[model samples]
Target: MKLQYWGTAAAEGLPAIFCRCETCQKARERGGKNIRTRPNAMIDGVLKIDFNADTYQQSMKYGVDLTDLKYLLVTHTHSDHFYPNDINMRRQGFANYCGNKTMLTVYGSDKVMASILPMAEAKSMAGLLQGVLVQPMEKVQIDKYTVYPVRGVHAAAAGPLVYAITDGEKTLLYCHDSGPLPDEVFAYWKENGLRFDYVSMDCTSGCSPMDYDAHMNLERNIAMRDRLLAEGLADGKTVFCCNHFSHNGAHSLYDEFVEIAAKEGFITSYDGMEVEI
Candidate 1:
């Protein structure tokens, strides 16, 4: 499986919209990996995770055509992660798709489905969108992939979800938009005999200290990784990646943050990073 990170920044993005922080300034000055958009990922060009406001820009920058996208998994209804309005763009008036399958199936929690269903049922977008309300821990089969939705500890209203995907050969744990997961989550992994090949975690706070449980810092990231390793959910061969950064985070610049993360054995994701598992 080839996993591509389309965007790796938090809600505000790197070089935030209207800020003069040192981190944002440096990101603007050094505009390569530092210039991150909102967080999102695509697997093998068919399955996508998180459709945020930056989707359009990320698509153009990465030279990806999303008209044929088959599946979309939304983590939450946060505007930065789930931009429902953009789903309309795939309708008849906006896009001219040549594929036989015109409908794109989206999976998310009840709240996410609620936010998207009404708009998708509108006359303009009726036949182009399909919203499936998936409960936490529900594993669903989508063509060649098995997607397991895990509940996240963020946004009560949003009911955020983390996804574990496997093509029956390699497994990827795409965990984000939440802090450290509950013990039962890990227990479930052990029960299923699940071992991940690639693990992408939340690093919204970067190297800073956070008092909340909605997001993770670098320290929390390592702790979580260590726990996963000790529990046999991840091993030395697993590729651990830290993503979803914020400009306000300590050592927020890509180069600076990566140096810190690398020392502790983690890959700091950039806007257009790709990994093969």
Candidate 2:
């Protein structure tokens, strides 16, 4: 599986729009990997993880053909990750490209459906957009992959989710915007004998202290990695990536973050980064 990270920042992004903090200032000074947009990723150019606000910019920057995208898996209704308004652009008058014939199926929780269904139903999006409500732990088949979503620790009311996907040969665990998951989630993975080839985790808090349960910090990610290895959920060959950064994080500048993450055996994800496993 080829997984590409289109954007690797949290909601505010690196070098946040209005902030002038040290981290943001350094991020502005150090472009390249330090420059990040909201969180979003794609697998093999067909399945997208989120419809971030920066989708347009990411598409242009990476030369991605957004119209050709077939499947979308949303984590939650957070505007940074799930921008339902843009999905409307695929409608008749807005887009008349040949790629429009490819139906885009979005899978997410009921809250995700609630957010997009209203707008999608407002018009005749008939063949353009389709929303599927994905329940926790229920396997959903998407083309060549079997996707299993587990409820996340964030946004209880929104029914947030993290996904585990496998295409028979390789498996991926995409976890973000949440703190350490519940024990049951891990047990489910063990019970099903699902081992991951690639693991993408949230590092929103970066080098800062992880005082809350909403998002994870670097320490939490490291601990999670150890646990995954210890529990046989991931082997030494599994690629672990730290993603979803924030300007508020300390020592989160790309170079510094990469140096630290490399020592901890993690790939610090950058915008437009692609990895094959």
Candidate 3:
């Protein structure tokens, strides 16, 4: 499987809309990787993690064939992660896109499902929507993969989720926009001795004064990595990565985060970053 990072910024994106913060200013000065959009990812060009607000820009930047996506797994209905209106483009007569009449299976909690269902209905996108699969805190098969949707400690009303996916051979933990692991999720990992080939965590605050609750910080990520390793849930071979940065944290702070994560055997994901498993 091939995984690509589409975007790597928190809600407002790096160099946020009209902020004059030093970090945002620096990001504007140092473009490239320092520049970030909303958070999203693509797996094998078929499975997409989220349909962010910046989906169009990400597609254009990476030349991603959006029509190739077969499944879309949504973590929550957060504006940065879910933008159902953009998905309407897949509807017939909406746009002349390439690729076959792709089927996109979206899985999420009830809140996310509710948010997307209306859009899918209005656009008459049943052919493309496939269905809204409500996620549970247990492993379930979707297409050819086993996906486990774990409850996350994010917005109480939004009903956030974190995912652990396995395509028979390799496992990937998509942990983002979430705080510390819930007890059941940790128990499952501990009892099963689960090890992920790739782990993408939420690192919204990079050594900033911002307190980490729903999202994590550099210290939290490092501590989480240590715990995963100590519990045999991670190995030296595991590719641990962090993403979803906030503009307040700044671009230079992200560089510092990358440096710190590198020392701890973690990769800092950026837009267009790809990994094959």
Candidate 4:
């Protein structure tokens, strides 16, 4: 599996769209890793984790061919993660320039559908978006992969979902657009003998010491990472990646953030970063 981190910032992004804070300004001065867009990623170039406002820009920057994206697994209905209206760009008259077939299979919660349905209805996009309402513990089959929607602690605007994707060999746990993994999800992990080879955690906490009601800080992420290690859900073979940052965190510099997380055995993610499994 090839995991690509197209954008690693939280909703506002680094050098936030309209932010005037020192953190944003500092990022503006020091480019490169300091630059980040909304959180989004791709798996093996075939599956996408989430869609944000910067999806198109990220795709272009990373040279990603969206036409090959077969499955789109959404974690929530957050604007930074799920941009329903932008999905219409795949319609026949819109992006028909791609020579290959471009049907996208979408999986998410009911709230996700609510966001997509209106946009899909607005356009004549028929087969462009094949959406399936997913629930916790449901195993959805997409080609050679099996996807699981794990529960997480987060705001209930429309309810949130995290994903566990596997190809019968390796598993990747994408935990973001979420806070901590709920007790039920851990129980399911134990009950099903589930293990992850790759774990992309939410580090929105940045350098913060406390956890959010719907997000994780560095301390909470470390605790969660350690717990997963002890529970056998993660082992020496696991690739623990930390991403999805907010400017509110202690450090705005990517190198500084990576250094901090590295002390606790985490590889900080950056835009256009790709990890092979």
The candidate with the higher lDDT, 1 or 4, is: 1
Candidate 2 per-residue lDDT, tens place, 156-209, comes to 876689999998999999997789987899999998889999999999989999
**1-277: candidate 3 lDDT, tens digit per residue:** 6889998888998878778898888788878887888899988777788887899888888887777677888888888999877886778778554445666777888888776676667554655765566655666677777887788878867768888888878888888788777667877876655688888888788766545478787677778777787878878888888888886653334565678778777788888889986
Candidate 4, residues 1-277, lDDT tens digits: the string is: 8899989998888878898798888898888899999989988888888898899988898887776677888888888898876787877777774455656778888888876666555454665667878888887887887888776677787568888888888998899867777678888877877899998888886887763478887787888888899988999989888889988888746968888888888888999999986
How well does candidate 2 score on lDDT at residue 8? 92
Q: Listing every candidate in turn, what is its Cα RMSD in Å to the true structure after a full C-alpha superposition?
A: 1.4, 1.3, 2.3, 1.9
Q: Which ten residues in a row have the lowest lDDT in candidate 2?
A: 115-124
* Candidate 1 TM-score versus the reference: 0.96
Best by lDDT: 2
TM-score of each: 0.96, 0.96, 0.91, 0.93
C-alpha positional error of residue 125 in candidate 4 after TM-score superposition, expressed in Å: 1.8
lDDT score at residue 76, model 4, on the 0-100 scale? 89
If both were scored by lDDT, which would come out higher, candidate 3 or candidate 4?
4
Evaluate residue 130 in candidate 1 and report its C-alpha lDDT on the 0 to 100 scale: 83
Segments of candidate 4 deviating more than 4 angstroms: 97-101, 118-123
Count steric clashes of candidate 3.
0
Lowest lDDT sum, 10 consecutive residues, model 3, at 248-257
lDDT of 2: 0.88
Candidate lDDT (C-alpha), each: 0.88, 0.88, 0.78, 0.82
Considering TM-score, where higher is better, how would the candidates rank from best to worst?
Answer: 2, 1, 4, 3
lDDT tens per residue, model 1, 62-178? 898787787998889888888887887877777766555467889899988887787678676666788888888778887799888788988888879888899999999998788
Residue 190 C-alpha lDDT in model 4: 76
